[model samples]
Structure formats: structure tokens, C-alpha cells
Target: MNKKQWQGWGPDEQAEQHYLVQPRALAGGGDVRHVSAFLRASGWRDKSKKDGPLLMESPDRTVRVAYDPCILPGGWTIHGRAGDATVEWSAHLGRQTPVEIVAGLTDALTRPRSAHAPNVWAPLQEQNWHTRFADQNYTATSPDGAAWMQYRQDADGAAMWWTGAKDEQGNGWTAHFTPNTPMHLVQAFSTELAGPDPVMRPRGRVPHSAQIRTWSVSVKPSQLSAWQQARITAARAATWARTSARSTRPRTTARPYNPAGGARTRH
Candidate 1:
């Protein structure tokens, strides 16, 4: 829909418009819209209005996920807070970061975790990334060193951090899980980071353009996961229902229409 038409649309219709667009993917990953939808399904409440940052927060408001396309480098930031409120963890996903990758971290937050902490580095190590210790911190680097993860413990606290550089200038994405953030959640993010599948992004929006392979065609709705497709269906229904209701309202109203405002007059 054009800007004017979209502005006149109700939230449901506006959302359907987004769902209907077959977004192109870059080598880094899927659309952030999928991540937004995932958070909503996981009990997060949408706090932003239409066409603004996709901001959502947990029931307790301890966790938040914000996606703003206008943001440079990183367009998505997911955060969580610990009990005292002094410590919070965050993941800044670059615009090209795949939806599945971000969803991996968010999905982990919603599930129950065992007492034991999963090996945060195991996933990357298995992918043949190099690992080493330096200055009391454990660090792992991708074969090319462009991507790295580190775990540091100091007098202050322990934290996990990861960064993927898109260029030598250091423009890219970063994630930091501060002390008290669950290790399982970090591990889940690492696992998705290590997946062998190539993420999709639109050709024009890709970061580290020269470093990854390109696809001639964008991903179609048919290629989306069952969960994603289901969300699209729901959005479609919402938009249709709104349209249907509006169309029937005029016929059902007994009062004469007020031409000045298009409102109905009381009998």
C-alpha cells in the first residue's frame, strides 16, 4: 500500500501489509519481522505503534526486543534484565542478522532450562572455530577471525560477548550477556551462530557484501517455516475482518450519516 493508504489503515491492516511483502534476504539471515512475530507469540507485548520501531517487552517488562530499520549497522537489539536491575544483557543484531539467529536466542529465553549450563563454546568449536585463553578470558574466533566470542570474568562480574565485523572499520553486530544472564540462552545463540546454513538477506541490504555468496532470487513465502506462514495467515485474517466489519457497519446503522465527518447521527 502507498504511504497515504497505509496511514489510513488500522493497525491490523498495516501489519497485514508488512506480512504480505515477500522480503528479500541477504546472506546474513531472514527478516527481522519474523523475530518480532516470534517475540509476540512468546508472550511479549507489542509496545510500538504502526511504522515505528518494533518494540516488544516481556510480561514483566524485564526483557525487550526492538527493531528499527533506520538504525545503522545494528537494527535490532534484544535485552534482558536480572533480579537486582543493576545487571542486564543485550544482543545487538546487525540489519543483516538472520531472523532465525535472533529467534534462537529469544526462543531459548522462553524455555525452561536445566540446572547445568551448556557449553557456550561447544557449538562454535564444532564448526572448527579456534579457541584460546588470554588474560583470564576465554575467546573463540572464526577461521577468518572476523567473528569472535569471549567469556570474561573479573572483579566486577562474568560476561559473555560476541562480535561479527562486517569490515575492517569494525562496523557490524555485537552481543553482550552480562553477569547473571542465563548461560543456556547464550549457548543457544552460539549454536545458531554456528549453523552451516547460509542466511538470506536482500542483495541491496547485505553487509560484508564481498565476504558471502549471493542469491539471484529472494525467498518466497512458500519457503518460510510453518510457524512464520501461520503468522502471515493470522495477519491476513485480521486485516480481512477489519475490512469486513467496516463494510457492514454502514448498512447496519439506522441513523442518517453525518456528511461533515462521515459519522452516523443518533435517531
Candidate 2:
């Protein structure tokens, strides 16, 4: 579609149009704001400098989220540390990976810990992805064969769990979660990736383009889906609440929020 047509299309129409042609074309940078807003609402602080990578830290200062658009690959980084500060865990979302999917990771991060161990492979299974098991390793492949999640029980470091996605032309990206990274976070990303929901993106903004294939469709903004509408509303409300709380706080720029008496350092 032309610029005018693309600009006039609503969220749902854009999503439908994209999904019709390239179902794997996720809305990469589109949901970064939503992710940041959610983090702020969850009591994370924006510690980034002007025009630099957006750096946000959890209230307890044990976790940090970084989004650096200038980086070519692996621009999104989430790191968490143990209480003793000797061990660290991390997840990296490549620049081409959808921010919508990354938001799932952040959501899982802030959620209250569950008593039962999470089944990271369940989401893909629910979506009907083909799952294969080996001695101690498992791999889940998407229904369309465009994406995959692999787990190596015997491996350590980044190879423990890997997620990858590709377009029709073979252009692709991958995300890595360290061995020590929480399993729920991986499950959250798996759920988002496997879910049938479409991530909206303008034609040319898609992360990777097929060599010879092109597609576009347009519709009114009123066609937005109910779930997307609710998400937008909730994100905006959370942002407003966080901003209001910040504005009403006492003006003590010298000292930051630290409920614990010790120094709060980023991992």
C-alpha cells in the first residue's frame, strides 16, 4: 500500500493484511513504548540518559531492561542478578525480534512468583506446534515451520534455551535466554509467539522483506480488535498513574527510592 493508504489503516486491518501475506512479520519496534510504559507502571525507574538507549531498572535494582535501537543485532537486553551479586542471568532479544513478544517477557518478569514450576513448552504445545524430544533435549517447531524453540537440558549458558524466527526469503532472527534465566519468562515469550494474535506493522517497516513478494491492505481505525483496544487503554492508564505518582512525590533528587538501607546497584 502507498503511504497514505498505510497511514489510514487501523490496527486490526494492518494486522490482518500483514498476517495474510507474512504471518511471521512481527511488530518489532512498535511495542517498545508499551513495554516501557508497563515497566514504569510496575515500579521500574527510567535511568537512561537523553537520546541514549532506554535503560530501566526494577524497584529492587536487581533487574535491568535495555533497548538500544542503534545496535544492529541483540539490541534488547534484560539482566537479573541473585541477591549475593555473584551470579547473573540474562535474556537478549535481537533487533529484529518483535517488541510485542519482548513485552511478554517483561510481563512475566513482573508477575508474582508461582508456587508450582512453570512448563515452558506448554504454550507452544497449546498452539499445536510440533514438539520433538531427544535424550535430554526438546524442540518445538511452529505450525508454519517459520519459528522454533529448542531446549537442551544438558547444556549450559545461552545454548540452554533458544528461540528463532525466519521470513519467506530466509531472513531471520534469534533470541537467547541464559541457563539461569527464569523459565516463566521463556514461557511468556513462547506464549506470545505461538498465540494467533497478529502484530501490526506498516509494509516497509517489516523487519525482513522477501526478495520478490510484496503485500498490503488497508481499513478504518475503528476496526481495532477488542483485545488490542483493551491493551492500549490499560497501557495508557498505567503510564498516567506512574507519571502522577512521580509528580506528587517529594522533591528529593539527591536520594532515590530505596526501601532497603543498603545501596541499590544495577546488575
Best TM-score among the predictions, by candidate number: 2
Global lDDT of each model? 0.65, 0.73
Q: What is candidate 2's local distance difference test score?
A: 0.73
Candidate 2, 1-267: lDDT as tens digits? 787677645443433444223444243456577688777766679999998899999878989999987877647899998547878999888877777778888876765667888888898899899999886778999887888898876644325788878767767668888877877778888888787766666555656554223356653455544545666567557657867887999986686667878778986
Q: Please provide TM-scores, in order, for all candidate models, with all chains considered together.
A: 0.64, 0.69
Give per-residue lDDT, candidate 2, residue 184.
75
- For candidate 1, the 10 contiguous residues with the lowest summed lDDT are 16-25
Error of 2 at 120 (Å): 0.5
Where does candidate 1 stray beyond 4 Å? 1-30, 69-74, 83-88, 94-96, 153-160, 168-171, 215-221, 224-227, 230-267
Candidate 1 RMSD computed on C-alpha atoms after optimal superposition onto the true structure: 14.3
Q: Write the per-residue lDDT of candidate 1 for residues 112-225, one digit (tens) a residue.
A: 576786888999999898999987788887775566778877766655565443435554556566545667877888787667666544445555544455445534333445
lDDT of 2 at 31: 50
| lDDT of residue 52 for candidate 1 | 78
